[model samples]
Target chain A: MNAVKAIFLKELRVEFRNKQMINSYLILSLMIIASFRFAFSIIDFSITELASPILWISFFFGGMFSLSPIYKREIEQGTKEGLLLTPISPSSIYFGKLFANLFIIFCLELFILLLFFVFFPVNIPDLFSLLCIIVISTIGITALGNLISAISSNLSQSEVMLPVLLVPVLLFTVIMSSVSVTSNVFAGANIFDVLDEVRLILAFDVVFIAVGYLLIDYILEE
Target chain B: MLKNKLRILVSILAIIFILISVYFALIYTPPHEIMGDVQRIFYFHVASAWISYLAFGVTFFAGVMYLKSKDFKWDNIAFSSAEIGILFCTLGIITGSLWARPIWGVFWRWEDIKLFITFVLWLIFIAYLALRANAKSRTSKANLSAVFGIIGLICIPFSFGANRIWQQYHPTILVSSEGSLQPSMALSLIISVIAFTFLYIYILLVRVDIEKMKEEIDKLKQKVGG
Candidate 1:
């Protein structure tokens, strides 16, 4: 408990002590969202129907792109070795990174969600359900992202490699379920009607996190 | 060498099976009542799908073994099997889409759970290969991809079941033993499956050997540098 909290605190301190990452991420996401506005400018359909996919696409990719450096600093400065030398269980390290990723992504995604509402507003029939979708999907995304970034952090080209590896495997289930719930809500479906997608996202989060937890030791093998 | 002789035997055997299977498929098997020559694709299509699953099964097994024994040999087998699995999986998807277009009036069916699962499964293996490519060290590549290989195997059932969670009817051909297929068609299907399985084995052997030779060259390079 103490080790996990300490590591978690350290991560947060590193994250906020320098606001460079968050500031850049905020700008990057807004730029992508603006470009999307231009890209869909010529489409004939109501932009409201396009809102869910756009929101999820920008936030998901933005969250993913922001992750290219999650472990780079640790790896480059040999800080990961220092942490490993401590008596903290590797699973705790996994949890610390997982939580940090989940928090940072949620913040970034919330920023994009607010921006999206302004550009192409859709009445989210159930705010609670939409929140559920965001929270669960973020967990699933970061769970997989942490492992992928960990895998790529030691490589020569971490930036290009993470997405090529991460997108295909995680994108299908996460995007499909997230889009399902969000679009259903946009179309004024009741929260009960969206339970199936919610369940799928929940189940995906559990399975993904559990798998990452169990496999982290193997991935970080000496 | 004895190994060379065995390779010759296996190669000859695979060739013969493929020829006989092709003959049985096109000539010996009678055409379907509702559909004509196009149903012939079913033999190789279903067979390739089955063999692709088999190749992935070998990969899953090799992954488990590598994690247990930490042997580079098992990693080689896993890597080769995944490559072969992706090839056959792609063939399966193309052939399946071609079949769907003629009969179902759509090139792809989102409602068909099997089709969806096969597409996702194809994506998973492609990602597995991409992950393998990104790893810098030989051991790390093997270890990381082995972990992913096991995870990918677990996703097989989930991807198959993913659509079933919404709608039940997925149009499975596995339940075809109830006299739906004629005796001649059954025989052709069996022969096609056998041929493809042998083809899988032959390719696996050649691929693993190539991996070994590459490793040998790498070691020789290191020795010269050292």
Candidate 2:
């Protein structure tokens, strides 16, 4: 438990000190939202219908940008070797990084969601249900992204390789999440309507988190 | 020398079998009443998709072997087979779209689960190739790609299920709530399956040979330099 907490704090401290990741994600998300707003102004159709896909598109790109640096930074600084030299288990390292990435992105997601609501009219009668969908969907994305980032960090073009490797695997997660969020926003569907999406997200989180924990040791080894 | 001869024999037999299968498809098998001659495209479309799936399965297994043995040879085989698989998969997607265009009135539709999954498969392997191309070291590239190849394969089931979960417009191919296929269509499809399977094996052998030759060249270069 101490090891896990230590690793998690180390990751958070590094992220806080650098701030590049947070800045890049926030700027990219803002640009996406602003562009969507401009495009909506040009078009005559209802923005509410377009809101779901647009929000997800922003989140997708934001998630990709946020994750691209997860391991590459460590690799560049040769901190991976230092981290491996620690007494902590690889699974701890895996979950620590996973949690750190999820926390930063979750915060970014909240900021973006807030900006989204302010910029666009995204009304839901049940805020709790909407929040639940976002949280579940984000878990799936972060889990899969962290694993792929670890794998991609070892490759030459880690930046380019990360997204290429990740997007296809996460395609289902994105689509399902988007559909659930959209249904909630537009149709005002009951929680039962979004249950399938939530279940899929949960399954994805469980599987990828396990895979990440199992594979990180192999990945970290020279 | 014996292996070479066997490869040649298999290649020749595959050619003959594929020719016979095409003959059966074009002349022997009657066209569907609903889809007309366009239905004939199913023979090639389904065959290529099956071959692609088989090739990817080989890739997945080869990846496992490479990871287990850390053998560069297995990695080479996995990479080459994945390339071939992508090639056949591309053809499958094209032929499928060509068939769908005339019948479904669209060359591409995201609603088709099989089609969408095939496209995703193509992207995954293409990315695998791109990763290999960019890697600095041979071992690292191979290991990374093998892991990816396995993981990419594991995602196929989920991608296939995406349509069912989301209520998409893609046609369910196997175990449809609708009844089984008509006997004639099923028979033609079966013949095409046998023919394409042979063809896939033949192509895989050829690709593996080329990979071996490249490996030999690399070895010779290293020896001379050293």
Winner by lDDT:
1
Model 2 lDDT per residue over B1-226, tens place:
9988988888887888788888878888787777778878888999999888888888899988988898888987898789889988999998998987877677887766778778888998998898888777877787778878877887776666665655532244342222235787787788888888877777888888888898899999999999
Per-candidate interface DockQ score: 0.37, 0.50
RMSD values for the candidates in order, in angstroms, are 3.3, 2.9
Candidate 1: clashing pairs of residues? none
Model 2 / residue B178 / CA error / Å: 10
lDDT of 1 by residue, A1-222 (tens): 788687778887888777877798899889888988888778767764677778888987889876777677788878888988888888888888778877788888999988887777666767776777788778877887787787778666778878876766666666655765677677776667867667776777788789888888888765
Give candidate 2's TM-score: 0.92
lDDT of each: 0.80, 0.78
Classify candidate 2 by CAPRI docking class.
Answer: medium
Q: Could you give candidate 2's per-residue lDDT for residues A97-179 as a string of tens digits?
A: 88888898888888888889888986666777767777777887887788788888888767888878887888664555555
